[model samples]
Target: MQGAIARVCVVVVAAILNHPLLFPQENTTLPDQDKELMARMREHEEKLEMEQAKLEKELSQLESKQEESSSEDGYSWYFWSTLSFVIFFTIELYRVDLTDTEIKPVEDEDVFSESGSVTPRTMVLDKDVLSNFCDKCMYTSSHENWRVREFVEGFADDLLESLRSVCDRDADMEVGDFVGIGSMFESWKVCKPLMCDLIVPFSPPDPYSFQFHLWCSPSSDVPPGLQGCGKIKVTKFGENEKGCLCGSANMGDDMLCLLHSRNDTPKVDHSPDELLCSRNTPFLAKDQVMKWFQISVTKAWGRISHKYDFEVTFRNLDAAGALTIRFRSGKVIMLNIIPVVQLEDTDAYFVSHFPSDCDSPPDPYWPLSFAVYEKNLLKHFAKRLPQNSCHLHCLQIVTFLHRKQTGLTGKSALTNYHLKTALLHLLLSKKPSVWGVESMEHRLRDLLSFLQRSLQEKRLHHVLIGNSKVPGDVQVPLIIRKAEPINLLRPLVLQRELHAATVRHFTKC
Candidate 1:
């Protein structure tokens, strides 16, 4: 910039010297007064020459300073780069990768012997490190969690009661008392926008009753992929029966009546279209069930909309009754109000889908859910376990890992159900003494190792099905206890490509 200014000054002096007013043509003579103007012009030209010289000097100094700055920046860059590498190396030495068996040590040893030989030692990660990690990432704030749960449960109670009233008055459906299930109720929830699962059992009005056909039964003719699934047949009770009758003959017209009654015709109030059954067949269709459920929930929410301070809407159209409630404070909560059919007063229920389910079974074949029983079993085990058992902690950590893995790799076949199943299996197999809080790290390692092996073998079984290890106090259904073991990973195993991807995902976890 200074160099350009010096050139501009030189140009200005030349223009002034050649100007007609300042300096006339060389061949022409100047007047006396003009001579004085010429002297002043010479002085002005000298001052311009001095200013140009000063500017050139300043430009040279600026160039020198810039070169110095460039050299200094290069040195600073090298210094910081080296320092960053050293810091990274130090951190890696102490860092523990959860998937690895042991933490890598700095160099190969901590110290050198006097004989110029290296002394090696094993560097195991401290148990406190794992404990701290669980506290940091695997657990949720209990007080905050309770606050949210209280608000959610209170809201849900009102909403569901309103829904029950609506269904009883307007539809052929009779909604019963809802039973809470899933991780939130089980008390191992870690991931957020707080979620809650509810099993809302319902029955058909008047003469209609559900007839469950289990795949595990000796007379079942279900497909191979339909293991652990059952079809619900909508059957009509005989005209004579007015209440919960014991005999199958009194329940449906398909069977011959045992007791004598004067009435010959069944009193049916609901049409076939209004019911959840298929057009021709008596079996309940899942698609129709979802459609009916979505519509009923909408109407129910509409009825109680004025009572609540939040807005409720369906989270996913494909999911039957998945709802999201948004508060004025910008807080959101997810609630899954699953309509289920109780398996003859047992803890198990026939559900359309589980909260952790990634895929839906074929239409009309509802999968059996023993979530309530599982929750009970956990409670039973908790009482028997040593004080401050690490079983829940282990479960939380594995589930956290599964969540993180799912996020990294979008929509894997592996799910939270698989992780929970693995934990339950381990709990049943191992002694209660092994689950003490101090052994949390070991238990977590074992859990992961067990999960990895199970994924490899593709043989994670249903905990309540054919499990002789289950405690009698847990009250699992007798039929489920006697049935053949249903492998949960069978679907993943059948599809070779999917199974491979699922295994890779678990390994990463």
Candidate 2:
């Protein structure tokens, strides 16, 4: 538009200059045609000027319209952006509210298939509800449970100390430090009985030491049923034979300690008869130990019976040291004081029976217990896991559920130890981040699903034995870690009815 206006102005100026009206030659006369042409040029100049003014006005209007349109676009963008942010915030608040308030029964049909079996893949947990229950009922956060534990443990300590003193004074068996194990000590106890499982390690007096013969060793001829068991040999130090009395004086041909004359009959001694081993055998015997322990406990209680108003009695005659203490206030606390032989100063012990064993293991062979190491493994992971981790919570919840289910359906092949084993396996397999307190529900579901799969496969291996996933920081003996993984669910393989019952119990749980 400007260019056209400029062209018109140039034409007008040229026409006026060439007309001889503005810059005239001297003595020049204009003809009529020339005068007419000058008037026409003036008219054309006026028209061009008007057209230039109209073009300028249109340019100004177009610029104003463009500015208005840009302003409207800016307002629209801001409005939409603010609206989107508000909507997102509102949705987040609603979602959180639902998560907190929504609580549903776990036995929903969506968790199972039409065939009434749990479909592991589609299973889900109501995180908020489960977490709430765990925090309220399962964890040791309750003051009543804590106080009971403290009171029971304090009384038990005094009781065990008295028992140790009695054993040392009257019997040859010397009680060592008591190792705390099981769910109570592990801070996962969720049910009644409020039991404290203690491993009382005892050694022989004076010159005696324990020699362990593990079934996993190359020289072992142990039966298949005794896979995780061992035989403990009571041997005397500095002597080739077990409990042998032959000394240096009889080293050569004498074959007898001879500080006296030959006619002085061999010093009659029957102390070996009082030892923990079987008659005429160096191997430790479970029956002998139990009998001796029962007597010792009775004597110990007799000595301390005057101090307390509670009565302590054997919970089971078959179990070596299962005791129940009943207070005058009607509070009953169970104590399992298992006598164990330490395996070469390691965390492992050759226990008379595993707490989870359903049948009595053979008397000659003692089952190996990694309970101490299990406790240590949990402590080792404490630093690695998030603060207030849900790992233990998940375990407690499952075990509590299993206990309730068992009460409803009677005994089954599944045990608490199996549930704990499954949890330990998941702890190793999953990342530490997965065990945060916020993830309790998810972890609980994962644990159940893992158990379901293990049950289906009929294989739930021991966590400490032959498990490569265990962290090196745990104090597991190298031999046990390298040994073949023993299946905790092996009974299910041999007994189909037991397997079916166990599966039903687990599903109900």
Candidate 3:
């Protein structure tokens, strides 16, 4: 150790002497300050030489057996070694802190986007250091990602295959009886894919029909501009559900005769306020569809070999309607197969039901979802982007911190899905160059600031809505074009006390 220190000092001194910054030409003029600085450098060099000499003397003493006897009399050497290692590891993780002072925040515009975006200032963070930190996180998270996805998705495929085999014989189902339609299927998810969102589309027997419903303030007249809610209209009602427009005299001609028009099948007793469709009460009831999935999927899962090596067995199906895929290996994932409706043009009806819905609306039209389109939009935007674009790293970093501070739960105001939407919108606004890895800190600050502004304003336009900047060439519903911006953070905004709480959360920073 003494010899290594001596060699390091020699190299540093040699480099300083050779360094161009240290030299001044004979003809060059120098201020008194410059002269004093140069003198200080010379003194520093001399002091280093003296220190090196003292180190060598100590090394000589240690080489002698007398010093060895003194070392043996002290505490264990590994104690100091472990302490040094912990310190080294802590230094490496310094950048992971959200409040790292190197990030210079850009000012956001309070007014709507008129001309340009918030221009980020060039930050002075060490490029190599930031890259190293991100690389380390990504390496470990990638491994955890695979285990959850592999186990969950493998089970999903087998389940889907079983549904296909049965649906082939069961003439009542077609086109929409699918499951597991969200983020778990995507490759960009980080850490372990802890949760899965499954959407089993309700295939109401034909002639019953379905139409998309926009939850616009239960008022008698809707605004012409349709602000606050979206359109879900042929563009809405399923092709077969759109009768006469599907180039057929009867849209139900090819469909099964399970229409409520006939009295052959008895109607299941339901409460009057339960939002049953007036035209077809028996066939396409949302609650009944949910009940069917709960029973059938559970039965199918039970018939499969349960005592597998990985030990994935039939966990109970949720009462409200979703299949829960549990794992005996580890509590790494929570998978749910949800029952949903597939509208040709699904609208933004439930922006108020964020985090998680507090109340179930008495509507027969099962609210539609745009999970498929969102994934496609992200996948397309990422195609030409550089591998290390901060467009991704910003999200990965923020999400890592978010999970640490709170968690990946619907109970919180923040969510990974919201972050994903923010990134998509930013991609639409900013040029590709702005998302480079070098701009990570600035980009991340920008996203946080944007979210902060959204929370304050109580307005976060749905990505599927045509109001915000939609990505080029991505098809969206026409109703989305006419929809007014909704207050997605309304629930959070309603509580005055939460403002202080939100401020505290934002300051984590």
Candidate 4:
């Protein structure tokens, strides 16, 4: 019985050791293997608890970070949306202001009479006022039509101011002067169309003419009509010796008209007859002689003629002389030649005779005659060497004189004398052969020698050197400084030669 009790007690002790929490003393007193098993169970429980706490903490941190990131993104989106709304509202308000601005149609009274009466409707503008208005409108208005009108008006005013400046600068020149005429044409060409088409209300009359009748006022308030007023008349020349009829009259200050045929009345239309007529006379008819005048001026200035050989031939005996000028192809004049001569001084004559210049004077036997001539040798050369050449030659001659006065040598001397002589000889030879042919080569050689000696002595250098304020110590060689002057005598020299030759040829024939 006691042995049975001992075995039961051993089994009880083993169970106690295995159940670690049931008996602490028993577990401590257990064998090494049982103690190690109890230690492993405690370690596993601690690791499981730590793992659960760590996962919970990480999840909480992720939730807080996500909430913060969402708040920042929402704030940025709200700010941009609010800013865009403000910008859109501001642009709408500005556009509304531009659209609401009023533009009154041009008044009829503003255009017609110099009396400040708004009678017949005509289009006119105060250029200074219009320019200012245009500047404001260009930046302020979004309307395309208004913008275009303003831009055009501003451009026209600017052009007019420029023209006025030019005129003021050239106030000393007469209407007959080429420079004056050219300026007038340029101004008219630019301004007339703008006035008729866009700004001015008056129906453009026939071939237009601009007459400077009224003096411009310095006061800004001066009426445009009174500031530059002049009459536009529609006149018809009578048959034979019967003067002309002034049919229609228009108010002044600014006399601008469009040329139209009488048949077309107030409307502007291109009529070949009117064009042809204007080519012969400066009338308001659709036909105008001014067109031809314009063409002739361009041709003369440009030196472009269909007839390659066109020339002026002068024949003189003692105090009296005859001048015949013609333009022709191989041997035919495309148009008639008209000639006029006005004796100015013992040494001078003013000739205005060309189909391009005037109508054939009544009598074919008028002191000056109009004739068509075949292009001959004289005609050929004259046309080839333009009037400009004569002026150039004159300048060269003056240069030669100057160099002769200053006796400089080597490259400088050769440049002044030899080079100039060669150029002068070339010019003279190119001139009509009728001009005297006697001893040109010998004369040129002597002139060159004289120029070289003059340069060495510093005699004529002043003439060639224009207003270059180089100090005397700075010795840059002098050169021909400006365009040569075109004098009346230049053309006459060639004319005289041709006349003499013609006379000799006719007499021999």
List runs of model 1 lying over 4 Å from the truth: 1-126, 137-140, 168-171, 239-266
Clashes of 2: 0
Best-matching candidate per TM-score: 2
lDDT of 2 at 380: 79
Q: State the lDDT of candidate 2 residue by residue for 1-509, as single tens digits.
A: 33333433444444444433333332133354677767776676667567656665765665565434355556664565566556556756775565444433345665777767665466666677786777687753557667766876676677677778776543468877677799888888888878888888888775577888898998997898768998988876656744434433346664555434446544222255576777788889988888887787788788888988888899888777888989888988888888888898688888876555668677678888898888888887888999989998888888888899888988888888888889888888889988999887778778988999999999999999999888888868888888998988888999999999889888867
Each candidate's TM vs. the true structure?
A: 0.71, 0.71, 0.58, 0.15
Looking at model 3, report the run of 10 residues with the lowest lDDT sum.
Answer: 347-356
Model 3 ranges with Cα > 4 A deviation: 1-130, 143-151, 163-182, 216-288, 310-331, 345-362, 407-411
Clashes of each: 0, 0, 1, 46
CA error at residue 465 for candidate 1, angstroms: 0.5
Candidate 4 lDDT, tens digit per residue, 1-509? 33223333443334334332432322333456786777876676566556546655655665565544355556654555565556556756764464344223345433545644222122232445434543453323325433334543443344333323333221111112111111011111111111112111111223332221111213223233221121222232222344323235644535443533345443244343432323333322211222333333333423333323455333221101122334354321111111112121111111222222222222111211101011121233345543422322222333433344333321121232233333333433333442332333333334444443432333333211232332232222232123121121222234555434322221111
Tell me the deviation in Å of residue 233 in model 3: 13
Question: Candidate 3 residues 1-509, lDDT tens each?
Answer: 44333434554454445333333222133455687776876676676567657665765665563344234323334444455456545644663342234333433332223433222232234567558767887656667766766776677667655655554332333424334444456555555536666555544433234444454434413343333332222121333454434344465656544433334443333332232232344324444544555555655555564534443433333233333444465554556666555554442122111223334333233343566767767777777676767776777766776666564222356567666777777777788767777788778778877776776675566677545566545666665555555544565667766655654454343
Off by over 4 Å in 2: 1-111, 121-124, 139-142, 168-171, 241-273
lDDT of 4 at 318: 13
Candidate 1, 466: how far from true, in Å? 0.6
lDDT of 3: 0.52
The residue-by-residue lDDT of candidate 1 on 368-441, one tens digit each, is 88899999999999999999799988888778867887889877888888888999999999999999999987
CA lDDT for candidate 2? 0.76
Ranking by TM-score: 2, 1, 3, 4
